[model samples]
Target: MVFISLLGLFLLSLTQAAAGSQLFDQSEVFALLGDDVTLPCRVPSIRSCSSVNWNMVEEFQSITEVVKAGAVTAPGGKALRLDLLKDCSLAITHLELHDARLYSCDIGTLNSSVSLQILEVTESSNPGVDTIELHCFLNTYRGYAPCNNKGIRIKWRSGDSKPINGDRFKVVNPSECFSKLIITKKLTDHHRKWKCQVTQDDTVKATTSYTTTIKGGIEEVFAAVGESVSLSCWATSSLGGKGGGKWAVGERTLTHDMSPHNGPFHVSEDSSLVISKVSALHAGDYTCSDSTDQQRGVNKVRLHTLDVTSEREPEGDNVTLACVLTCTKECGKDITLTWSGDSRNSWQSRSMKVNNLLTNSLFLPVLSMASDEYTCFVHRDSDVMASKKWHTANPLQTPAWVVLPLVLLICITGFYLYNKRKHPKDAEHEQSSVVMTPLYEVIQDVNNEDLQHQRQHKRGTTTTTDDFYDLLQAVN
Candidate 1:
């Protein structure tokens, strides 16, 4: 039925053109809402004539003269938005929804018609429900005939050009002219950036972006110590001139120079503050301002670092895994640390003040069979703000001091046993040799004394044979 009506309109238009003596041409122009566009008068007979006139169909089928005699004749405030062109064309700037209309350009012996349509985005958010609703649609003049949208579609996409589809995203297309996107908000979606695109035959005809504000209060940006961090400034407006502005920590303004001599803090091209190898000293309140407008306090962000360290207990057989969280601002009571691992064993974290740092320590058994992966989670109530995963030992690997002594003891015992087993025969042989040495020495002495006696007897003195017999009895 809709197609029959459209065909009827096309036939009626042809009939009207045939009845009119002037040559008639018709075209449809698509434009983005809030942008500028020109409606061309393609009639070849058109000349640089002051008699060229542009008129639009108003509500109640009234004709309103927008441009007359090469001049903008639009009423009141609309006159500022309309312009006349040399080729009898009509130019509109800063277009609004009401500007979409069926326009007629009349020149000498020729008439050109243009139907203007605009694509726009509108949003409504419910803070209580934590949801945002976006509507992308085609806008035309009220009471005017519906503009042609045969091959046009409105779609929602993420910043990375991926179509948004998940449990948190609900999409509804109520009509061919518009689409609605509903998003459930999450803490991780603080940026809340989305894009709406109008495509015709798979080609993008118009596009717009919607980003929620992170302003109105001080927010936190988490970073680990010794890691690079970038704190983004709220880009309220397009930046111009030297830079977005200055970034300051506490009262000291950060340097913007990109040279190597510049300190760790540098201002990025997008006006974010980039810190290289951020440390505890970098934890503080940071503020970004606009340079061109002299607007101060454009954004305020609190920098916090979650640092993890492990130490062996001095007096116990346990390892202390400490999560030290440093906040440039006051730490909320909801902030907490949770230790998680693959093992079923659960360790409780104890909060303590050590060396002017707030540390949460988890004491695990020295011989824990937990897996190599352990995570330290920084949580605010039920939400995980940040987490750090580290590799730890299972059976908590024995220290070198404990292992070295055991190895040394085993080596020494092996050496002693080997020597004792290998030389048993040699020890027995040595004992028998010691027993024979005394007997052999006594015999030698006895023989020597007898020889001396013999010599004396031969010289006319009798030698004592009983002394030799005494020596032999002693040897036995």
Candidate 2:
């Protein structure tokens, strides 16, 4: 009887080894964190076994059954996460780091096993800068332990299939299990998604993606009151072109497919948000997000109205020019008021801020009546945000209406004087011609009378020489 029992035990050990060998290189499986994963079991006896069981091999070779008799038996919702499929494989949903372990499926005396490793991706960025770094690595044991990376490779790509390797995007391989993707922000970087892939022996094993969110890095958009403005998405001309996107302002939300008109806002065909007539109410944070509800970009729009007025200083003949800039409380801080053009001493102006309103004043002494175009600049740090031009004619300066008549009178007087001097010689010649004509006529008459007298003398009528001489004197 003892000999028979030994032989039976030997046969049982042989059968268990045969069943485990049926797994056929089912050694490891990779799954992305927070995703659903399945460990396959294809033993030939799976369908004919009297009972199917799924177990997790814990540390120190301890065995914990998760599924028994083709049903989940783990505690609480953990049991719900673990399910036995029709083929006796084990399925896990909403996978957690703690789920990474050696998983096994047992069919009576037959068994198969696989090791689970989690692929996780994370991102980091500096404040006030548009650069970000993404890290992808294999992890296990609740992210405290590194998984073996023999023959494993990691890579990064943009969107779905665009490989990322250029000046703006750089990939660094610190290890076989670790990868880093550095991105310098651009317009196209907004609303973009990057994917990390884990491959072993040239076969893709796991993938995960990270989406960039615009937080402290805001794109400032400035517009004047009553002017139309378009708030485009950070990257694309059309918002949500990849999947779908939406525009948000405070508590209000709008989708890409919405009607063209929503109050003062209009959604164009290209999916840009247009403000028909920008007003104080439109100044605030505008956010664009993808269909997955991930924030892609932010627009901090500043809407303001600028006006300038002048008055005589109470103490002197100097004029006080005050520039007023008005906006809503939603306008962010860091605004400075500066004046350009006109007097160099205008740099000595004074500025004050009350809530969202700012005033800059310059004092110009009464010297000469002059017209100057003074511009008020709204400054944020070294960058100029907006500017408004005000044409100031010193109250001491001649009015435009008064100057017009003076200019016309001066022009007429100049023309009259020029014409009078241009024809002096012609006027003298005309006067001389009028005065000398009668003298010439008298001389001609005398010559005619003399000729008549000469003819008479030649006809033999004796006319004395004294008579002829007296006639000549009378004619002269």
Candidate 3:
């Protein structure tokens, strides 16, 4: 009886295990044109007795057994045999655009389905010039739906090398069903074999290539620091594929082998180098090359160094050392004054209005004999382009006593002249009157009066007018 009970218990365990080893949901399907894609199928549980099968359902009432596990009904019936049910996934090789459709997977009594969609991508009809604009479109395919309502990856190649993104090239999405790749700047490298690759779900499925001749050489390149830059390495002729471009620092190579994407350095399509922060270490000679392409071209860029120092002075007895700027245009509007010294110290600034010829002065008041350095920076207001340390002049100190003597003399002279003019009538009156009389005339008149008085006394106190007149005439 114990043996019988143990066998029954083992049978019950097997049944429970079988029930747990079943697939719960459908698998995901992916398809791409001109490329192979995988159809994923996963079983939630694993059981020894469970079986899985993959079949292709096509046409009405027609089911073909493509893969089978656990059981087989007919031999040599074009059915794929699966020795292990765990690896029951389907792989479609070299899938065409028409291969996009629903697929089925069945396990024991459970069944699930998946759908896939394919998109076609073609090469650009016009590969575009470095300076000219280019537009790329999708290619046409048979037995496939319109290449609409799906996102496609667009990439390019120049000659045998891979294409990269830069300021000159951009992708534009005009509508839900279409996108355009535009090349803003044209270069001679754009004339080589150009290709467009379409990718769906990280897999490149189709590619189209075109050949176009590019004109002109590289002119100017502008790039930012710390960002990746790509340089176009194309040629003018079809045989110029071997004659591409390269990047260099002085004589050093900065091509793909020396620096990959996100490597120590990078370049743009117009041969612009992107150095992050652009420190002194990044300062060096940079050159773009196309020796391999046989065109043998090079471009150079120089990195500049910048250093700044600021100072502040007290209001009194402070000397300001300012930088004078020579402006080609109006300096007043383009110039700015700033003081950067003590963190807590505030800066004083004044701006002059711009004119046909700009002249700006940064004024600093110095009350005493304190020497303080001041900096004046001039910049173009429109571009914020500043001049180098063009003018470094010391502030001059002026004393108030220098003008004091002249001011006092002017005040004294003005007061004296004002008083003389206000009393003009009194001056005239003083000039007209004589203060001193002749002494002889005064003595003669006194003597005559005395003699007349004596005579009158002598004549008993009576004197006639003729006697007074005679006395006056005798005195005269």
Once fitted onto the true fold, the runs of candidate 3 whose alpha carbons sit more than 4 angstroms away are: 1-38, 42-50, 55-66, 70-87, 91-101, 108-110, 118-121, 126-476
lDDT of 2 by residue, 1-476 (tens): 11222232334335457765333324578987778888887556455323877767555445677888877888767887877777777889998876767666667656666677788888754422667777887763222234344678888866544466456667777677777788776542443467889899999888888877654445556565556778765533343454244677665676544422344766555556787775545566666554444544444333355566778767766877787767645333455778877556533578878777788997777553244777777764334556767676545456887688778877875764465468543332332222234654564455456656666767744678888788889999
TM-scores for all candidates: the values are 0.48, 0.42, 0.31
- Higher-lDDT candidate among 1 and 3? 1
| 1 or 2, greater by TM-score | 1
Name the lDDT of candidate 3: 0.43
Q: 229 in model 3: Cα distance from truth in Å?
A: 8.9
Q: Report the C-alpha displacement of residue 52, candidate 1, in angstroms.
A: 2.4
- Candidate 1: clashing pairs of residues: none
Using lDDT as the measure, the top candidate is: 1
Which candidate number maximizes TM-score?
A: 1
Q: Candidate 2 clash total?
A: 2
